[model samples]
Target: EDQVTQSPEALRLQEGESSSLNCSYTVSGLRGLFWYRQDPGKGPEFLFTLYSAGEEKEKERLKATLTKKESFLHITAPKPEDSATYLCAVQATTNAGKSTFGDGTTLTVKP
Candidate 1:
């Protein structure tokens, strides 16, 4: 079975503080790993897609990295506007359209 776990259920950071969120997973065969940011009641917004180990993607102040068994979301000098729930999900080679998702890490960046 494919599984995903995100650490630090919640994180508190001051504006300009940089941090990284962890996403660990296990799958029969990795197809892709995804990162998303979700606001209070809105659906998650796509951030990155990693296809293989050592793959990485960046957008604005966020960077996503993938390894064989895990992924990381690095936030650089975040602002209050960066506060949101970050979700990690993975698709397995055996599962074409289904993905296993982690509960998510809620980040609150305060000024």
Candidate 2:
């Protein structure tokens, strides 16, 4: 089964706190993995895409890394404005079903 799971469900951090979020997956035929950020009442904003293991990308204070079976998003000294829900999605080689998405991690940064 092609599936993705994110850990911690939710996280609360101080304005300067740093943390990491995890996304684990099991896919029958791998194609690509995606990450997105969604703010309340808004659609998701594309963050990064990973097509192979060991690929990594960064944007501002957020860094995303991928592995054969899991991915990680590391936050560096996050600020209150960084509070949002982080989501992960995966696609298989063939389109027999909709892209599977992780449950998402709701992060709240307090000032």
Candidate 3:
């Protein structure tokens, strides 16, 4: 079974405060890790695709890093507009099932 878990279901931060969220996973055969940002009532927007460990991707104030068993989303001095649900998904090599998503960590940046 491939499962993903995100920490701190909700986070509150000041406009310029930086923080990092964790995404942990357990799978029989790990194929890939995906990061996405989903705004209210909108579908998830792809952010990064990590194929192997020690790979990192960045865009603006957001950075994503992946490892063998987990991944991290580091927010650097986020603003109010950065507030949204950060989702993590994983594809397993063995099963042909759809990717499994984390419950998501909701971030709120106060201006």
List per-candidate RMSD values in Å: 0.5, 1.3, 1.0
Per-residue lDDT of candidate 1, residues 1-111 (tens digit): 899999989999999999999999999999999999999989999999999999989999999999999999999999999999999999999988998999999999999
Task: Give the TM-scores of the predictions, in the order they appear.
Answer: 0.98, 0.94, 0.95
Pairs clashing within candidate 3: none
Candidate with best TM-score: 1
The runs of at least 3 residues in candidate 1 whose Cα sits more than 4 Å from the true structure, single-residue gaps closed, are none
Worst 10 residues of 3 by lDDT: 89-98
lDDT of 3 by residue, 32-97 (tens): 899999999999999998888899999999999988889999999999999999999999888656
Writing each residue's lDDT as its tens digit, candidate 2 over 13-74 gives 99888999999999987688899999999999999988899999999999999999999999
lDDT of each: 0.96, 0.93, 0.93
